[model samples]
Each structure stands twice: as C-alpha cells, then as structure tokens.
Target: MRGRDEESGEFFSPSRSQNRRDALEVLALGEKLVALTEAQLAKLPIPDSLLPHIRDCRRITAHIAHKRQLAYLAKQMRREDDDVLDAIRDALDEDGEAARREVAAMHRVEAWRERLLADGDAALAQLLDEYPTADRQHLRALVRGAVDERNKNKPPRQFRELYRELRELIVGGSAGTDEEDADNVED
Candidate 1:
C-alpha cells in the first residue's frame, strides 16, 4: 500500500502499477539504445556507467539471452537521474533536426545546380550574390563544360564536378548562415 498522510491525504510513494510502467518505459529505451550502431551511440549523451550494460546487451544474439540482458540494462538505466535521461532524449531529438537541415541543404544545392544549368549566367549571378566568396570564373568554366558535355552526349564528368563544387560551397555557406542566425537571435 502507498503511504499517505492522515490529515492531508497525500501519497508518499507511487503505486505498484506506476512502478511497472516506469520499468517498461526504461526497458523500451534500453532496446532503442541497443539497436543503435557504435557511431550513432557516440552522438548521444549516454552515461559511462550504462555504456558497459548497453554493450553487453548489444552483444547478445540469442533471443532469450538478449531479452534477459536487455532487462538487466533497463534496470541499470533506471538508476540514472531523470536529468541524464532527458539530456539523452534531447540529443536524439537534435539528431533528427540536424539530419533534416542537412537534407534541406542538399536540396538547395541541387536546385541551384539545375538553375545554373538552365539559366546560365543569370543563375550564376544570383548564386554569387548569396555566396560572394565563390570563384566566379571557375563556376563559369564549369557551367560551360557541363553544357558542352550535355549537348555533345559525352560523359558527365563536368556535370558531376559542378555538383561537387556546389555542394561544398552551399553546404558550407548554409552552416555559416545558420550560425549567424543563432548569433543574431542571441543578440
């Protein structure tokens, strides 16, 4: 029975059902952690104390053994403070946001590439306007080579090179802009 103050009627502890629910939640989180690759795990804010437990859980291949090890990992994870768990969750959430930003940047690069191919100098002027540090003459040469390759039905070596150049320029520029935006927000 949960202890309660006689006058105020406030419970001092959670009931058994709540305890089981909390345990299951931790178990589910442990399963997710175990499923992640080593590189992926490095990106999260997991604690050193739970690392061994997580690794052991990951090493088990047998169904029953893995389940048992997972339960053990969950028990260990339950010992962590709520703040630690929240930090890990936030890191995981940030990974999705970071991936979305990267995809958006790639799409932006591809769109610029198509515009450059289609509109030639007009699009080049717009690109240089945004990324003033870009090499104007080099980009013009690339666009010319790409257009030549397309019309001649030759290999797309220049086309691919243009894509590589645009990806490097635009991805780097977008990262800089994101940082500037954050700094502006702070001010």
Candidate 2:
C-alpha cells in the first residue's frame, strides 16, 4: 500500500519547484541592480540627486534580505515546542536593533565620504599638508578596500583596521610608526 510511483522516481510537489524558481529570480534581480549601479556611476556630470536614492535603495535591499532570512529561519524552527518559536522571535528582535545601529553608523561614514569627495582638491591638499609623511596611495587603497568590503556584504574587520591605520597615519603625520598623541587631534 505505497503511495509514490516506483518507476518514475520523481516527487510530485509543484510548490517546491515554484519556490526554487522564485529564489532564482531574486538572485537575478540582485545581479541586475549591481550592474545598473556600476553603469549609472560611470556617467559624466553624474546626477547629484540620484546618489542618495541609490544609496537608499542599497540600504533597503540589504534590510529586506536580512529580514527575509530571519523570517525563513524562524519558519523552519521545530514546531513541537512553543519555546523554540519564542526564542527565535526574541533573537530576531535583538538582531533588528543591532542592524539599525549598524545602518546608522554606515550612513554616517557614507556622509563623510561624500563630503570628502565634494570638497575635491582642497580637501586632499589639506590632508596632505596635515600629514606630510602619509602616502596618498595608501590612503586611497584603504578607502577603496573599505568601500569594496561594504559592497560585498562582508564583515568589516579588515576594513575597520585599514581605516584606523589611515586615520592614524593622517593624524600622526607618520607613515610607518603607529604612535599618535591625542593632543594634536583636531577632529
């Protein structure tokens, strides 16, 4: 008295296949967004108004994906015990708060970077004047690496270290030595 067919050796669930297709579509959409962003950034006289919108879209996408992952994990929790569901809910709440804090910090960093870019040569010249010993190439590398990590959805450990090193080099006016006195800081 077996229900499944033996010769075909196939499962007959339609919903499962649909779910996989939906996941593939979402992945494709993400790829398209990345490509679009790159193309939009390359245009001359870049539309200043669009930058904030682009950044906002990226943030919203990140937050939505995070929430979706949490929801999926919660849904997969064993239903035998109510306590497991409650724990998952609590954990998700905590994660949401942490994510909000991270987003706020990221926005601050983005604003500072935008300001630096807007200030143009004067800002760069001031940095050079303030930190004569620091290498501009190193500063650029650190900034680029930090941005790349942010774009790749990776942890910020190395990026943070690079940023700190760049900051130290700028503030201390020394490239090799990591010593920085607190008194000279203007920021």
Say which candidate scores most in lDDT.
1
Cα lDDT tens digits, model 2, 1-187, are 2245578966555466676675554444333333355554453222344344334445555667745543333233322244533332333343654455444444434443443445545554655675677677765666666667778978986567654554445423443332232222224
lDDT of 1 by residue, 1-187 (tens): 7899899998889989999998998888888899999999998889989999999988889999999999999988889998888777656664666566766676677777888999999989978987899999999999999999999999999999999999888776566585443342233
Q: Where is model 1 more than 4 Å wrong at Cα?
A: 1-19, 42-51, 79-96, 152-160, 176-187
Q: Note the Cα lDDT for every prediction shown.
A: 0.84, 0.47
RMSD in angstroms between candidate 1 and the native structure over all alpha carbons: 5.3
Top TM-score model: 1
Clash pairs, candidate 1, are none
In model 2, which runs have C-alpha deviations exceeding 4 angstroms?
1-125, 174-187
- Give all TM-scores, in the order shown: 0.65, 0.27
RMSD to truth, every model: 5.3, 18.5
